[model samples]
Target: MNKAQRLLHILMTMQAHRKFNLKELTEEFGVSKRTILRDLQELSELGVPLYSELGVHGGYQLLRDRMLPPIHFSDKEAVALFLVAESLKGYPMLPFEAEVESALKKFYHYSPPSTKEKIEKLRSHVLFHVQERGLDTPYLTSLLEASLEGRIVTITYEAEKGTSERDIQPIGVYTASGLWYCPAYCFRSREPRLFRADRITALKIVEDQSRRIDPPGYDLRDWFTGRPSGETAELVIHLTRAGAVRAKSDPLLAEGLTVHADGRGCVRRAAAISDLSCLADTLLGYGAKAEVEAPALLREMLLQRVNEIRELYAGAGG
Candidate 1:
């Protein structure tokens, strides 16, 4: 294997074993003992906890360090990492910001010369979807870290009712409409909910010890896989000329909703309606351009919202 590939293999071996001796690695890689020693030294320099073992059974082995940097990635991996990090620019305040930054810094620092050069090229050529109205990146980053670590978060969330501080158990990070959203189960509601990463003004990682308390039989993946539930309905949305572009490109809608061009914009159909209120609001945001075609109930849902707006604004100055 080439130097980069060899390094990756050695790292993988170290991760799998408590230690590796020069003789074993040399035999494994068909290299000299000196070369294996050099490779181990290189890994050590990169902040890997690889250490040489002495005695009869002693060999080079990775020390158990939870804080050790991960093995180097291939060229594609290097570029992908940068892309992921850059994308986080949309949500800056996530709890994992420091960890992500540290990991990236180390990865770049130890990346092979060719891989580093490729990363530079990739950085110049790539573009991320930028939000017209930006969000606080740091907060989003923190929320992400907390969520990944299974920590409950406290945030002053603005709901339709108004603003309220909620202790939420973040489940995963979701991206929608060029913005990141966190899926969580609200402690108050005891149900699954989504919080806009951008709209969250302040976030605090709660330490009350409430944990991965998913509902009786809640499976995030299965729920998102369009499972039917008592509280949720299946709603189909048909988009007009302008709405097609968004429907086709939106990650959330694109996965669950079937889309096709209808000369005007596009038509989308889906059978999951866990958040009809939010979905209706999204459709309304498209104005008269989008329509809910199937499930008469969803049509009524949108119409009710429209009537409410009409009633609220009637006789008011525009």
Candidate 2:
């Protein structure tokens, strides 16, 4: 085999065997011990994590984080993978931003010229548009790691009411719209709550074993699929044709909207009472286009907000 081919084969073998002596590699490949030694040095120069042990009992060992063997992908598969990675660029922050960029660079560098041209063209035409967010979420990686490890964390959170420190066991972290959120069991509230990742000013993993508790049965997937889990009240809103079009722009409300024969539509669904205030704010933006048919509580909140707005501008127009 050519040196390049032999080098790749040896790398794969090292990954599999993990611990082998130079004599074994030389005998397996029918090469001199010096040749095997040269190949090993080249592998190390290529950034393979290879280490040698002293004495007769020891040989060579690949580190735990050794690179995977090469796998060929079809042109279409390569393009699809590029597109998927490109889509992640819409998000402002990612946990492994450097690794993603490195992978994308490698993909582009290794692709054939035709594939490179296609990717460059698609980069301009295909876009996954997400609203840009100004908030910084420096704790996103920490939150994600804690969730994966099922560890409790102490965070200083800046909520609308005020800033406070709390201990929480996170289910997971997810991005919605353009912001990151962590759904966790808050020890302070003794309930599941969703905290904005950007609002977490400080975080530290709690290593005290006594503080750990059994993980909740539900996780982020469950939270996303079947949300509004607690006690809920039915909400019904009548909308004009224009309101229907506008409501479709909102991810939260559009799921429950039903369009009628004429172009008018209605949002009819059960929503957690805790979410009524948020619903009120969203509907208030619709102004004359939307009318709350049921749920007097939402109407009251909307009226309260309107009155506050009126008070703020009451004498200004005079």
Candidate 3:
């Protein structure tokens, strides 16, 4: 965090906790004691109440009952808050929906009128199209809160086998591909595992006084950015001219595809196949325009999926 953000955070922490020594502040911010001392001085100059006690364990303390005054959010921060809140606008059954409304109101209230007006205009200039999958995320807020508080939760989750209970210490919540997921340390798995938030049928926060805390500096971004350790079988497919054109419309499919003069195309490199049913559905959508050149396993799976689709349609028609 920048100096402005750090100063603002220190002021708020002082207000909330009443006392924080230089050592505690330095450790929290990962800055030097001198830096924290300088920060405290800056906070004082900014009209924050920061009376310091001078003793062996002397720490700066806000006066009792002194609240943090209204803060002016930086321009970038205001815009960022607006964007982040906007992303959650059209979700299905979000947890703490009322809190979200309150937060958005506060964000707008704190934003400069000029910034608010510009944001209104920017709505036309900036657009984020999200396809909400209509999954119930009732426990999202609780899970997120527990993650921050280092609390454990017991969850009854539906999986391929059946519903099973797990005691998990959540690291954080994240979103990908229109799904919310929580990565947590699971007692059942004896390791960190990602749980699909929608599959959680029941949730109970473990309010026991003692609970396992998430490891310090546990970051969801690292989990997302790290290379996945799942199996990825490669697909070597040949596409007709029409299929190639269609694939071009989907950047993922068109990636590393090479079209030839004969109006047939092959992947410049083999494509990594993850979901058999999804790939089958896509390829089948192209009719005879797509042909699997290699991978007998995939071909069989695709054929099986095709037969299933055909049977379903035939029965429906009958």
Report clashes for each candidate as comma-separated counts: 22, 0, 0
* Top candidate (lDDT): 2
Q: Which scores higher on lDDT, 1 or 2?
A: 2
- What tens-digit string does per-residue lDDT give for candidate 1 at 1-318? 798789878887777776667778888999988887788788776667656657998766666864343443678877788878777765434456666777678778767788888778877887675655556544776776776667888888767778889888887776656666787878877666777876777888776764657455444465466444336654556666566676667554555554444645444434445566666777777887677776677788889988989988985856
lDDT of 3 by residue, 69-179 (tens): 556677777887777766777566566788678657755754667899877876767767666697887888888887888888999998755889989988788775577
The worst-scoring run of ten residues by lDDT in candidate 3 lies at: 268-277
Angstrom error at residue 279, model 2: 3.2
Backbone clashes, candidate 3: 0
RMSD of each: 7.0, 3.8, 10.6
Look at candidate 3 and tell me the lDDT of residue 66. Answer: 55
Error of model 2, residue 314, in angstroms: 5.6
C-alpha lDDT (0 to 100) for residue 122 of candidate 1: 71
- Candidate 2 — which pairs collide? none
lDDT of 3: 0.74
Candidate 2, overall lDDT?
Answer: 0.84
How many Å off is the CA of 304 in candidate 2?
A: 3.9
CA lDDT of each prediction against the hidden true structure: 0.69, 0.84, 0.74
